[model samples]
Target: MVRLNCVLLIDDDEPTNYLNEKLIREAGCADTVVTKESGEEGLEYLVSCAEGNIALPDLIFLDINMPAMNGWEFLEEYRKLDESIQSQVLLIMLSTSLNPDDHKRAEEMQEVAGFIHKPFTTITLEEILEDYFKSNGN
Candidate 1:
């Protein structure tokens, strides 16, 4: 498997983040897994990495429902970021919402590469990793 440089989990739920981090680490899908409690914080972290001349996460798992800035709002701001930075990070919408509209909205967003239901598992991570590497020809 081609391990990613970093993976970012942007969700408000602490338990979900903990479990996702553990699953990613156990699966060895990425060298670094970062969890942000909110979209705003996640955006800040990304911007900080760019400002500090640090590598950004190769994949991002974003939640739809957040307190201040929701996933859609984050994507709006994300689009305004430097093109170089935007091109490198792949965004995936990870949400528990069963709303078809949410899924449709995610699919409509150019930044969203994929969408998956929450409670992430190692198998899901593996599939995502495989698809990503295969698609990128890595």
Candidate 2:
């Protein structure tokens, strides 16, 4: 069996983070699950890891709206990172918003791997893992 990758979850909702972290862990989709309450903190963590040549997470689950910084703002900063380090991470936007514009914008972003609705379940985690493996040619 392939070893699961590390996951970085960026969401402001405490319950959502707790539940998603539980589901992701139970689904065996990640070896380590790191969560940040805001996009700014998430970006700071990534930037620090990049500077130290540390292993970056394989995926990032970002929420659209947060107190510190929104997902759009995170992406804007993420784009400024060195291409080598930037290319190592895959971003997935997770939001409760049912807005078509949000989905469209996420699709347009090259760094975004996919979009998932809020309150992720085991089934969704399984699908995400499958997709991730397939994309990585595993």
Candidate 3:
């Protein structure tokens, strides 16, 4: 098993965050799982990492319908971040929305590694580890 150094989750739903954090820990997928309630907080975390010489997360799971800064808005600002910081991150959009436009928008975005529906699962986590992290049959 390949354990990621960090995984950052940005979602407004506290229960969802709790469940996902538990899943990640139980799966032995990450060394640290940081949860932020809003996209603004997410960006702030990233910046703080850059300024404070802290390690940035290798993966980020973001939600689409946050209050302060939506997923799309986060990406807009994320694009402006230095390539050194941005290049090392793999971003995925997690949403409960069944909107076709949302799917299409996610597909069209170069920054998004994948768009998965809500209820982030253990299988999905394994698949992501295999697909993106190349965990070698994790």
Candidate 4:
């Protein structure tokens, strides 16, 4: 398996982050897994990484319903980031929202690689890994 350097989970729900982190660890698909409670924190992390303060994540699993800054708001700011940083990271919108509008919006966003429902599973992790890593000859 081609392990990713880092995986980031951005969600206001603590339990969701905990469970997802555990699942990602068990899957062994990434070397590092980071959990942030808000879209703002996630964006700050990305900025810090871009400034060489930390390592950039290979993938970001972002929740759509955060309090201060929602996933959509984060994407707006993310678009302004340097292209070098943007090119190396992939974003996946993770949400429990069953709204078709949410899915459609995510699909329309060029930066979003995919949209996944909540409760991250090993099988889903494997599928993402295969699609982004294995198929890419990583």
Candidate 5:
């Protein structure tokens, strides 16, 4: 498997973040895995990277439900960022929501690489990597 430079996980739940981070590490998915408790904090990290002239994470796993800024709200704000800053990143939705509407909404967004159900498994991560990164000759 190709190891990514970094990955970001944005979720309000502490356990979710911990588990997801552990899963990614065990799977050897990336060199760095960053966990943020809220969408606002995730955005701040991204902005800081841009300001400091640093590379952004290769993938961002965003949760749908958050306290202040929801995933959708964060996405809207993300769109306002420079294209260069977002060019190499794949933004995927990671949620426990069983609502089909959420899935559909994710599909409608061009920036969304995929929507993953919560409690992420290694198999799901493998598929995402294969489908998005490998297939595209990354």
Candidate 6:
């Protein structure tokens, strides 16, 4: 089995985080699902991981709306990081918003791996992984 390296879920909603974490684990999509309540916290976690020489997460699930920093803010911060550190990460924006602008913005971002609707299911996760691996020629 191809083990998922890591998954970082940055969402302010505690319930959403809980459900997604559980679902991701149950699907065997990843060995660990690390979560943060805000974009700043998530960025801090990533920076700390890099500084500690820990294996960076393979995938990131970012939420658009939050208290302090939103998903867009996180991506901006991520861009300022050292290229070597940033290069090792893949980001996917997850949101409940149906705004077309959000979709357009995500698509515009070169670093954004993709966008996923809220309440991610096993099938969605599978399709995401399959498409991701296939596109990367894994």
Top candidate by lDDT: 3
lDDT of 3 by residue, 8-108 (tens): 99999999999999999999989999999999999999999998989999999999998868999999999898888888899999999999999999999
Local accuracy by lDDT, each model: 0.91, 0.84, 0.93, 0.91, 0.91, 0.87
Per-residue lDDT of model 6, residues 29-108, tens digit only = 68788999999999899999999998889888899999878889888999998788768887889999899999999999
Tens-digit lDDT string for candidate 4 (27-117): 8888999999998899889988878757799999999999989999999998898888789998999999999999999999999999999
Per-model TM-score on C-alpha atoms: 0.95, 0.91, 0.95, 0.95, 0.95, 0.93
* Runs off by more than 4 Å, candidate 6: 134-138
Q: List runs of model 3 lying over 4 Å from the truth.
A: 135-138
Candidate that beats the other on TM-score, 4 or 6, i.e. the better one: 4
Query: Candidate 6 versus the native: TM-score?
Result: 0.93
Worst 10 residues of 3 by lDDT: 129-138
- Cα displacement (Å) at residue 36, model 5: 0.7
Superposed Cα deviation of residue 56, candidate 1 (Å)? 0.5
Kindly list the per-residue Cα lDDT of model 1 for residues 15-103, writing each as its tens digit: 99999999999887689999999989999999999999899999999999999899999999999999899898989999999999999
For model 5, how does the per-residue alpha-carbon lDDT over 1-138 read when each residue is reduced to its tens digit? Answer: 777889999999999999999999999979999999998999999999889988799999999999989999999999888898779789999999999999999999977889989779999999988887886553
What are the runs in model 2 whose C-alpha is more than 4 Å off? 135-138
TM-score of 1: 0.95
- How far residue 72's Cα lies from its native spot in candidate 6, in Å, is 0.6
Q: Model 2, poorest ten-residue lDDT window?
A: 129-138
Better of 2 and 3 by lDDT: 3
